[model samples]
Target: MPKDTILVVDDSPTEQRLVAAALSLQGYRVITAADGEEAIEKAAKELPRLIVLDVVMPKKNGFQVCRQLKTTAATQNIKVLLLTSKSQDSDKFWGMKQGADAYMTKPFTDGDLVANITKLI
Candidate 1:
């Protein structure tokens, strides 16, 4: 079977590049978007199997993006994994409420990130 593609959305070019490379190392195709607008557009256009989104981005945040993706018919079924710095319990609860499948804080290990992606795929 072919490896699934992952759409990674983050404002920091450094973060985006790091994640893209890590996922690529696992043999999955990686696509990137700089902000929430691009993330939404790419999610619709690419329809990736999963999305790795960062919170606290300009224009829109991960929570809003997750809700939008879940509410939209075109991208409703796609799994969303929020990778952000929001560590509070309430933040995680809100993320789930917004329809994300998984939420992880920043400074996560590559193994955990890849493991989450693998499990979801």
Candidate 2:
């Protein structure tokens, strides 16, 4: 069976690499975007099974990206998992309000990441 494709979006190269590595280890095909604009473009073109999106980024933030993805017909069905350092209750609420399928904070374990991806996909 073909592995599921997941788009990992984050401004930090380190974060991107970490997330991508974790997903790849789980047998998922991983694509990456450095910023929100790239993320939106990639998500629209690649139509990955899920997107692990960071909330803080240049050009546009994760909330903006998620809102756009959820509203746009081409990308609306793509599941978005917001991953960021913003762990406040309000941030979680806003992320969900923007149409994220799941919200996970940074400093997460690889197991937790896989678990969330497994559940989302």
Candidate 3:
């Protein structure tokens, strides 16, 4: 059984809960952050195996946070999976540039989300 922890970061409470619950059902320990700053703080403290991040958010946005986490040695190894409604090609490009291990657009199914998480974690 995989016991790795995952951090879900999103501004929408509804989205956050959906992601959290799905991962929890898969037996991965789940934690959540409502925005970028909190996400960064929790990622540092928890050292989770993966981080499910949202692009549009207050405080710091997912790309910025991903860059910060990737550049820092302590958190660089933590896999970052960018999940967002921003489906532009440029958005995907920039997400990869910022060190996102994977990018999945919003309106994703629970199975797809779990598949991505499993791949990353």
Candidate 4:
């Protein structure tokens, strides 16, 4: 099988690196973007199998990006998994409403991240 890729999108460098490191160690290729615009750019170019997006970001934000991706034929098939500090059910609902395939809260276990990605990718 072909290798799978994940795009980690977060304005926080620490969060981006943490997710990338954890996912990379699990044998997946990890790409990163600092914010929503960058996430869109990278997703268009890289065509990653999945995206780990953060909710609160400068510029377009994760939900907006997810919507754009889902609506765009070129990028619509790429799965989006929202990774954010937003813990409320409303947040999860909005994430899904915006086309995210999954929603995971911040400080999530590496096992959860890996497992979700495993299922999606």
Q: For this target, which candidate reaches the highest TM-score against the unseen true structure?
A: 2
Q: Can you list the residue pairs that collide in candidate 1?
A: none
Screening candidate 4 with a backbone cut-off below 3 angstroms (N, C-alpha, C), the clashing residue pairs are none
Query: What ranges in model 4 sit over 4 Å off?
Result: none
Stretches > 4 Å off in candidate 2: none
- Of candidate 2, the 10-residue stretch with the lowest lDDT total is 1-10
TM-scores, one per candidate:
0.97, 0.98, 0.97, 0.96
Candidate 3, residues 8-108, lDDT tens digits: the string is 99999999999999989999999999999999999999999999999999999999999999999999999999999999999999999999999999999
| Candidate closer to the true structure by lDDT (higher is better), 1 or 4 | 1
**lDDT score, residue 5, model 2?**
93
Q: Model 2 Cα RMSD, Å?
A: 0.8
Tens digit per residue, CA lDDT, model 4, 14-53 = 9999999998888788889998999999999999999999
Cand. 3 Cα-lDDT: 0.96
Q: What TM-score would candidate 3 get against the native? A: 0.97
Candidate 2: which pairs clash?
Answer: none
| Model 4 whole-model lDDT (C-alpha atoms) | 0.93
